[model samples]
Target: MTEMLVPTELLTGIAEMDGQHDRLFQEMLQVKNALLAVSDDDAHGLALLSRLADDLVRHYAWEEAAARRYGVPFADHAREHARMAAFVQAKIDEIERGVCNIPALMVFMERKFESHVAHFDLQLGLALQAARAARDAA
Candidate 1:
C-alpha cells in the first residue's frame, strides 16, 4: 500500500516550524518511495526507517525549542513529543533485534503521523499563531 504525502495544509504559519514540516514531508515521501522500491529488501527499509526516525528527532527538537521560546505550556507538548519519539525508537529497536514487522510498522507510522499532525501539531500551530499575534499586538 502506498502512503500519501503529508498534506501541505498542515504547515504551521511560523517559518521555522513550516520549514521543518516541509523537510519532514519530503523525507517521509522519500522513505515511502524507498520502501516501495524495495519491498523484499529488509535492509533497505530499515535504513530508510532509521533516517526517518533521525529526521523526526531533529524536527521535534526544533519544534520543542520553539514551543519553549513561545512559552506554550511545555508540559503537555513535551509528553506528546516523548510518546511519539518513543514509539519510533521502539520500532527501530525491535527491527534491530530481528523481530520487527515492517508492513505493520509502516501502517502504524502512517496512521500515527496523520492523527498526530491533525491533533497535536495542529494545536501547536494554532497556539503559535495566537502567541505571535499577541506579541505583534503588544
Candidate 2:
C-alpha cells in the first residue's frame, strides 16, 4: 500500500495552521490519487498541479507572516518554503515541456512534505505558541 502523504497528527497545534496543512494535503493527495489511478496522464496531472500551485502560494504566505508574528528568526523554515514553491514551479515547467514523470515526482514530494511538516512545521508551531505565551505574560 502506498503511504498517505497527509500528516496524521497535529504537528502545528495551531488550529489555522493545522487546517491549512490538511487542506494542502487534500489538494496534493487529489492529484496523487489521480496520478496513481491513471498513470502518465500528463494533462490531468498538470491541471491539478496548476490549481494546487495557487493554493500553495496562499498557504505559504500565511506561514511566512505567522513566522514573522512569532518573532522566530528561522532561516531554514523560510528556505524550506522557498524550496517547495520552486519545486512545484519546476514540475510545472517539466509538464509544459512534455517531459513529466509524475509518479516519481509525486513520491518524492509526498515523502519530503510529510517529513518537513512532521518536523519543521511542528517546531514552528511550538515557536509560535511560545511567542504567544510570552506575549500574553507581558
Candidate 3:
C-alpha cells in the first residue's frame, strides 16, 4: 500500500491551498507507488514521475502567487521551492538512469514537505488571515 503523503494536520484553514495540497499529496502517493511497484512497466512508472514533477511545479507556483497576494515576503519560500524543484529533477534523473531506489528520496520529501507546510505555509496562512482582518477593520 502507498503511504499517505499529505497528513491531516496540513489543513491551514486556507480552503484553496488546502485543496491544492490534498491533490499534491495524492499525486505524490501515485508517484511513490509507481516507483515502488515491482511491475515491468518502466515506461508507466516514468510517466507517473513526470506527471508528479509537473504537478509539484505548478503547485509551488500557485502557492507563491498566493503568498504574493497575501503580502507575504516570498523570497525565502520561493527559493526553497526552487531547491525542491531541483531535488525533484535530480530524483527523476536518477530514475531515468535505472536507479529507482527512492526510499531515501521519499523520506526526504516527506520530511521537508511537512516542515515547509508547518513553517512557510503556516506563515503564509497567518499573513493572509491578518491581511483579511486588516482589510475588514479598515
Candidate 3 per-residue lDDT over residues 59-109, each given as its tens digit:
899888877776779999899889988988998898788785776777677
RMSD to true structure for each model, in Å = 3.8, 3.7, 3.0
Sorted by TM-score (best first), the order is 3, 2, 1
* lDDT scores in order: 0.76, 0.81, 0.79
Least well predicted 10-residue stretch by lDDT in candidate 2? 1-10
TM-score of each: 0.81, 0.84, 0.87
Measured by TM-score, the strongest candidate is 3
Residue by residue across 22-85, what tens digits does model 2's lDDT show? 7778878888887668566557867888888888889878888998877887788888889988
Model 3: how far is 1 from its true place, Å? 21
Candidate 1: segments with Cα more than 4 A from true spot: 1-4, 36-41
Task: Pick the winner on TM-score between candidates 2 and 3.
Answer: 3
